[model samples]
Target chain A: MMHQKMTAITALEHSVEIKAVSKTFGSFHAVNNVSLPIRTGEFVTLLGPSGCGKTTLLNMVAGFIDPSAGAIHIGGVDVTDVPVHLRDTGMVFQSYALFPHMNVFDNVAFGLRQRKFSKSEVTHKVMQTIEMMKLSGMEGRRISQLSGGQQQRVALARAIAIQPKVLLLDEPLSALDKSLRAQMQVELIEMHRNTGLTTIFVTHDQGEALSLSDRIVVMNRGQIQQVAEPIDLYRNPANGFVASFIGEINALPAAIYQASDREISLAIGNIRMTAPRRAEWQFGQGEMVQAFVRPEHIRIATSADAGCNVVTGEVLTHIYQGSHTITRLRVDGLGPIEMRLPGGDVVGRVPVGMPTQIAFDLSQVILLADKSS
Target chain B: MTRQRPFFVQFLVPAVLVAVIFAAAMFNVLKYSFLEFVPGSLNVGGFTLENFTRINRPIYYWVLLDTFILSFATAFFALLLSYPISFALVRAERNWVRSVLVVLAITPLFTGEIVRTYSWMLVLGSDGVVNTALKSLGIIDRSVPIMYTRVGVVIALVQFAMPVMIILLATAISQINRDCEKAAANLGATPNTVFWWVTIPLTLPGILSGFVVVFAWTMSAFSTPQLIGGGKVLMISNVVYLQGFSSFNLPFAAVLSLVALVAALGSLALMKLLTARLEQNMATS
Candidate 1:
């Protein structure tokens, strides 16, 4: 299965290399000195919380807005100053920005017509793309006649029909409901596999970023926090932002008491615990730090007995999400910790106000010194 | 949803009132179109189709042709002048400009049609200020005789018809989405092509309606044509008036008035039919 999926990948020729990009709206910088290379035929998502300059970077690549200072090259040719139309990139908007006046056939043919394709050529290509998108007979239908999902597919087909060097999708599926969004994600992945077109997708939804991209560039506040493969970024985030964004992570302030190749002991007030040190940075005798561990990695202990993985805590609340549970507990020194548990884990009722301890693998935790966060 | 009043009685009140008034007025015209003069009697004694058939006379044909030609000329000029002006009004973003545009577009519509036409008469009349200025510049010896000409009639009609076209075209241009223009630009079309293909087509339906409205309005207009024609240029309305009041041939006048109404209605129907076909072609293509 992995081989087939890999076979679907093309390592396509380098499509866009946005270097040292910075876009400022007046004195406020929307995208500040962001540099990321877009691999050809790879689905790269710029993921972040809102206002993180992901969309601004995508716009610079699409040439919708000029960058303050940057060099952008598509297909190895510098397109830093190219107009949107001349850049020859297709952009699919979140709103599905399909032309209301034109029917499906003519809407898809619009770009082809601009390039002066022959009448027969435009018709054949448009029909073929419509069929490829599984909208075979929708050519005669008006744009408003189609559902949201169908309109998205038509937009996709229209974008790809021109055979643009790259596709820039600005949160294309964000407007869709969850189940439909998931379905379109699969379809989009399949389309990418079939076409080998370089695509840069932007979104604030973390799950979408994780599931769709070959690599995710997690951003925070107009700057890229980390760029890594989804699995790697989830398993090992470069800093606090990626750790908290990709999944449920517990961030606790700790001081590195001692460090070695195998283990690093950290202290939070009177509580001290030792976890494996994966970071390359060396700490002296005492340095304030941030320790991150995934919520799922923590195991709940039924009783507190001064065991190896234990903490005396007062339970504040319990939330029942289907198939799982979240317990909000106030540990001795830690303010409050949320523990996620799957169904069928506990034998007795786990109600609020009862004390519980959470245990976790030492190696799964990471330490960072980005105090600004 | 049915009303309690008797069907024809409910319909007939206003219907009969209008029909009776129109019929009585045209009856006088019928008497005029057919009355034969007793050589010296100036006596409207016998009935004949002389004046109705006399429309075949060369003078009447030329006058008829000139009336249509002038109406069309005015319609074309109004369309040309209003389209861009309306575009600016629709696209203006500033609040003051928008309010000012609304006032400017509405001012002409608010004025009485004859008041506006007579205002043009003051400007166009020979030995009026226009010819007086020309006489001073030595551009012509006598006050240049342009007043009471077809040119003066056309000028008056165009000014009278302009406000309708402005409001209609503004409404049309306002209906277009700016995003469509951006989409065209993104597709590599230059700004001009976007206007020609996308913007113009969207506004065509509006232009068609406005054209038909102005066409019917000009065809039925009597005062401007009468006051400006000055007895020299005889339009259909003038002839109709002469038949009803001067000649008093009621039946012939009735036929001619009906012909005028039919002509206006026919053009309206033609406008709708052509546009519907255009819409059908747009959909299929």
Candidate 2:
């Protein structure tokens, strides 16, 4: 079954192809020259902050907003000028947009009814979809009568019942409470896995993007910053924005002192640190760059430990976060830095206002080119 | 709380005084409705039901029925004319377009009813704008009778009620979740389908309320029908005017006024019951 599904997926071209699309509103450019090809049955997320044009791009794909330039194609057919109803793309809005006057069954059957499906066909399909969405018993319930989570499920069931060519989710979880949002995220992943439908999700929450996406397209200022798998995106963000956006990172201004094929020496104020010079990094000797270090990548060390990237700092505060603890420190010549230790490992040892030695795991450090350079 | 007590007293005093005076006036009218009319005299005679019994005649019955029909027609036509204007007022993209629509829709309210009725008379008269324009275009060989007719009175009343209807419908249209329309379209519903299926259903409450308000407002209309109907279109209010002022039958006029008030309130109550049932049905289904 898996083999057959793989072959079926490979037999079709990209499910949705955005060809250098641009949307401009008078003087403001909402989305600027963005081109992305979504593979068949791939879950790609457009991750960015608000006003980053992620929703604009998704709206273009959904045919709600037309691009000012370039074209959009679904299932290898150009649908640039097509109207929304003809495009066959399902969108789950942030507000859910469930017809308040409609029951769950009718909402799910709306698309089928519009397509003139026979009565029994619509019933069977809608029932199957409602069951799949775990909304079987609530089929007769009105939208307002359901809980928020149930309403969200109905929205998903409605959108997916049509089996649209591409499912575009525009921050569908933003309205839910944090716990509900997390639970729904897991359900969404399961739903995506079962359907194997090409999906494009848009969100401002980086943690959501990291958790739920197969590949994340990080965007900023109406432009895509990088497109990579979730693990790669977290470990190797392309720019300072993506680095800071994906997770908490201590970005210290550094100057490259010496560059070699394997490693590069960087100067942060009076302190010197060495980081692996990956093949993708292109920087000249003595070039200014921002060294990004994840909180978890920085380790607590002692003065007896010998390392080329070790620094001494005073422990500022230890934040207890159940599964992990974040030890904040005021490092010399580097301002404030945070280190994440598993459990309460550092809680009793790292006292506030006391001097402590910290080490930067050189291999995991990310170096981004400074804008001025 | 103590400091605010005197200010509350000051505000309450005038409102209470005004309420007492208004209630006294209504009490006088109610008392007059049961009294015997002294023919050709301002002073009423002893208490009697003769005025109400006089209203039971076929002539007065027909006039009451005509008033109800005309009011219903005015509200229906007003809603029809105002819906597109309201939609445009709320949905127009440009600031100038919205401003223009707002001004056009609401400016009729600024003109007094008498002035507006006179303007309508000029427009609907035998040799007026409509007749002259139709004559020149050769659509009609002679002037079509609009003045002193039910059509002319209904037309004027519809225009009079349009501003309030437009404002109400605009509020409804603006409050609708725009995402619902977008979602409908995304679910393979055409624009027309989306409008009928989603937009209309969602704004039904607004449409029903606007219709009822205009219906009640037009039911009590006196000037437009009196002037445009040329005293021919006898609405309940017009009958009351003729009895109270023209014929100096204050008792009969008061009875007519009370009937008109009861009819308007009764219709509004009926409409409220219907809309509540509709909303309940909508919620369940």
Worst 10 residues of 2 chain A by lDDT: A1-10
**Native-contact fraction for each model?**
0.26, 0.74
What are the runs in model 1 whose C-alpha is more than 4 Å off?
A1-13, A302-306, A312-319, A330-333, A344-348, A360-362, A370-373, B1-76, B90-115, B122-164, B203-285
- Model 1, A42-81: lDDT tens per residue? 7899999878999889888888789999799987889998
Worst 10 residues of 1 chain A by lDDT: A1-10
- DockQ per candidate: 0.22, 0.52
Q: Give the poorly placed runs of model 2, Cα more than 4 Å off.
A: A1-10, A256-264, A275-287, B1-9, B277-285
In candidate 2, which residue pairs get closer than 3 Å at backbone N, Cα or C atoms, i.e. clash? none
Best by TM-score: 2
Query: CA shift at A156, candidate 1, in angstroms?
Result: 1.0
Interface RMSD of predicted model 2: 2.9
**Candidate 1 chain B minimal-lDDT segment of 10 residues:** B36-45
Q: Candidate 2, what DockQ? A: 0.52
